[model samples]
Target: MVCVFAIALLLLGPNPAKAESREQAVDRLTDYLFYRVNSQLNNRKLQTDDREYIRQWQRLREAIDPRVKSVQEVCLRVSPQEKGWEFTTINGETYEQTYDRLADTIFYSRHPQRTGQPIPTNDKIGISEWSAIRREMFLSNCGL
Candidate 1:
């Protein structure tokens, strides 16, 4: 059903005289890509484990940018094989982020280069090396 709607919308692009807003486009994109019941972000409705991951990411953002007063909204960019989230402020800055719950690590592209080394190709970061990169990102990008 969503695929059908998406195809129709694409075939008939937004009215040239009046464009759809950014939020509308994102909502449409989410629907087109995934089929699921809309999930709410209420903390009381979440499991303990799920809440812990949320806390971790919240802490990460604070460590990165303490001046961020409030987050207006979040959007998830999902694929069948992987998932990530985007946080946006009212001021229009977006932080595209992904978290690995098992490894307890977060990846964001704010700082592409790892400290003290040339960025490597085909890098696979896991628990062992997460600390170094985490520290590098915190110091360089996050205000920590």
Candidate 2:
């Protein structure tokens, strides 16, 4: 019986030294948070909001080397802003601008008007632009 239990444990458990890396764990957590929040907010949610959220988790991922053993530690180290999470835009803008833009798109259908300029449909946010895209966010909002 003891031998059988030992075998089961060996097969089921993560190897101690080769356990999940912090980045993988953080990615898993980020995915779960994104899923739960988007499920609740439904169509009212913008997928990009997870950007800042993942950044926070990545900070935690950097801070801690070991796999998380308790929710308390994670909670202590990371918590969402009581208000909208701070985020910026191509120009200088706060999370409020994103929120207002979202509102205009959803509630008012007046999203086309941005600072008296029509929303540029030609702008494509691609992988090559992520560095520049996040540069403003990293400089202005992300404390990390």
Tell how far residue 130 is off in model 2, in angstroms: 26
Tens digit of per-residue lDDT, candidate 2, span 74-129: 23344553222222332454545543433222212212234345434564542223
Window of ten residues with lowest summed lDDT in model 2? 103-112
lDDT of each: 0.35, 0.38
Error of 1 at 96 (Å): 17
Error of 2 at 53 (Å): 13
- Pull out the clashing pairs in model 2: none
How many clashing pairs per prediction, in order? 1, 0
